[model samples]
Target: MESNSSNPYKDCLVNEERRLIDERTNVGTVEKKKIAIHMAQSNSDNHTKELDLGTKTPKPIQPILSAYPCTGLGKDRRCFQPQWYKSFTWIEYSITRNAIFCFPCRNFPTQPQKGYLFVIGYQKFRKVKEFLTAHGETNGHATNVILWNHFKQSLIEGTIKEKFVALTKSEIMPPGNAHYCSPPLQNQMLSAAGNIILKYIASEIREAGYFDVMADDTRDVSSYEQFCICVRYVDKTNTPKEFFISFEKVVDLNAESLTKTLISTLNNNSINAICVAQAYDGASVMKGHLSGVQEKYRKNHKMAIYAHCYAHKLNLVLISACKYLPQSRKTNIGENRASWRNFCQNHHSSENNDHIRSYKIPIDTLNIYL
Candidate 1:
């Protein structure tokens, strides 16, 4: 068989034709079976090669399986360094003497070294260990306990006290301006801040000579009984300022109780007695003639009047008009007729009967002649 160069499909067919001829000549009737087996083996090899190219090999990662040490000298102990030793030389000296001289050095320590241990007692020693641990230094707990005990012993012995002394004047003030003393002044400032709001309210009331006070009782979010006393007044420049003077938790709101609270609050603030006017809603308890707050004040100050609330009076008038104008009448003609009949019935009695008879006789004579 000859291959065709111009067409690729014809060329492949020619190659197959040559292969079949070769197989037939070499193996006779068994040639087709051998060729099929060879082609199957080649396809299997190509498939395996493709799979190998697509497969991935995993890499190993470092493991963190190490446990903390059982013994005192662990990794944390190896990295431990006492931070307090860096600042004070006495600490370094004590450590060196403890390591070298042992018991002899403790019996014959220098004056300054004993004094330093006395001031930094057990409490301070424990605090220093905490400070080291907070800054990433570990394994100082046991050593801190030992040092703290030693320092506490040094405080008990007088050998540590005679080493150093300081003379402090009575009422020694801090350096710089007096305002710079923040520790004590901080408390003062806190108290002043509390009073600032109340003082401001008083100043506002003082500037506004006359004010109307509104008093009411209400419960707060915390379920505490509280009295809300608000002041409405105009300032010197005629600008109105309305603010709460008192919103405080109270035990009771009885007449005596409320009056006592009012007197105390007014007197404490140096407020004039006549400058304040009280206004409240038409509550029976507040305006009752005998036992109400209005009556109580009227006993002392007769001018203490109870003005009828205009809004309530207007409501009464509207109700009366609606009751008289039933059936949605444009004009109350029925009401007028009823009013005229009642007037005539009341006026036409024994004295008015003679006047009515004379007027009727003239009317009758005129009617006959006509």
Candidate 2:
């Protein structure tokens, strides 16, 4: 539909098409369509973008406002004080709804309770302080608050206050009133927070009834062998999760010493009995069938089957495959179309290749993967 077309046939078709469309829907404007779509979507329980509490990624609007409208109500004239918004930063004021909503709970509700703060927003201006304070103190509220903080941490890799400053120096929170600015206090706070988070992860693992153990040893910058132990389990939602529980200096690298440390760590957490699997790199000290770390762990929990670390095997494979590469491919393949040439060579060389030729079955792939 080019404007002012010279061809009469084209002009006639365009005008006729426009007429039919206009007749079908008298108001075919984009604005009208948008309004209709919004009206249709408004009845559902789904939250619209406006009420998503700035949780959607790829940047979000600043939620904390400097001034919350004081909706004066009740006999003693109780209302939402604008100053309160400063103290309780998790609360968000809705202009359209004329209510305050819990920003954290709205996004990450810990329970299936139907609190107004989580969805429709809270408008009980009368006794607002009493209810708001009580809501803040709830375990669910605290959990969601922590979760919201964790979400913010994911969006920006920095301290909470630093995140605030980076986001816009938080409206309710002034820069001067910020506390725990000192390094020592920050370290202490971080340690306590880590312990709390670790406790929650450990509790979730134990609650899941069964879990797998993962341990690896690596040399730190100072050349000290650091033995790290972690656990992998499916959560209540059936989503797999791995949480690091311990990272300690390895005074001894012997299988017995490593077994003792690992066993003690699991016993302390009371998950040693329920351990269903243990994965470690193919090191003689760790995976040796005869009295190795795996054998020692299996002695206590026979159900805990041993597995060679997949990632470790992949690393070994990659290193071994590097030896098969041509010197031309191994050279500066990054520069001047070398990578492209190598990729083309590999692609053409693999043209007739089939999965049957590479691996007869899926179990074969798994066996090689292990």
Candidate 3:
């Protein structure tokens, strides 16, 4: 018999496998269609039932519980509860007892007597009313005024003077070693505290071996000149730490004035120089060649070097670019002349309507002069 070179059995097996796969694929398609039809029928039935009942499906309910623990206060004062629950409990108690009073007189006893009027002055009453009005706590200014006046009259005659005496005593002998003083007096205390903090910061800086200084001035809403001085140094952990050593009030912001202010503030706080590096705003008075703050400091301290502020350099560059460049023209001579003309025209315009004007220049033109 001749040797069978072709694999007939293998070819037959491959044909059978292809046929089985096609049959299985058709079966899967049919099963999916049946499942889709069944789902549609079920949904239709549910919709019909809802229509007949004339009721919408109820939404899944969400829990209205909080994550924080709820607790009750006992005779022991040390027991703590969730902050929200405690606040709610106090509010409920106040409402039930009718103990809630205007913020200014909340601590006073209920049904204030005739002599209690002296404790709260007319100015304070007015201030409280104003505060309430500003904060939208009460409506009708006239009603607030009437209620405040009635409450005022209920106070005792000598109570105001007594309260003042109590306040003075509190200041002189604050409870628990904490300070108690009026805001103005508190400001004076803060100034003294700031001086102490500065001394501590300076001492820390000195111990650190060497440091750089960053100084700047800014105006507040009231246009008060405030100067900020900080020491930049790397701590033992090799991390950069900037300690704001002082915030001094300055009379003027000129270069000489600022330099004088800086020296005076540092000297008062006992911050001695050790290879000083001054960083300031790029204003002429601060960074200028002649009589600038850095120049003034250089005269006094030979080791003082002005660190050129990158931000200031960028700002100066942008300002110069805008001033010398004209609309649509970038060539230095043409742009400058155009800008000058536009500025002159805008300055002379009667209605200041020059903003609506535009200059024409070729878009394809490129000038290296700029």
Quick one: best lDDT, which candidate? 2
Best by TM-score: 2
Runs of candidate 2 with Cα error greater than 4 angstroms are 1-179, 270-273, 326-370
Model 2 — which ten-residue stretch has the worst lDDT? 39-48
Tens digits of per-residue lDDT for model 3, 286-364: 8886889898887877777887765555454334445544542455645476764554345335433233233222211
- Better model by lDDT, 1 or 2? 2
Candidate 1 global lDDT: 0.44
Q: Which clashing pairs does model 3 show?
A: 115-155, 115-156, 115-157, 116-155, 116-156, 117-155, 117-156, 118-160, 119-160
Model 3 CA deviation exceeding 4 Å by range: 1-181, 310-370
Report per-prediction Cα RMSD to one decimal: 38.2, 22.2, 30.9
Query: TM-scores across all candidates?
Result: 0.31, 0.45, 0.38
Single out the weakest 10-residue window by summed lDDT for candidate 3: 90-99
lDDT of 1 by residue, 166-241 (tens): 1223345444434433566667755566577667767777777566556666788898877776666787788888
lDDT of 3 at 129: 31
lDDT of 2: 0.67
* Model 3 local distance difference test score: 0.49
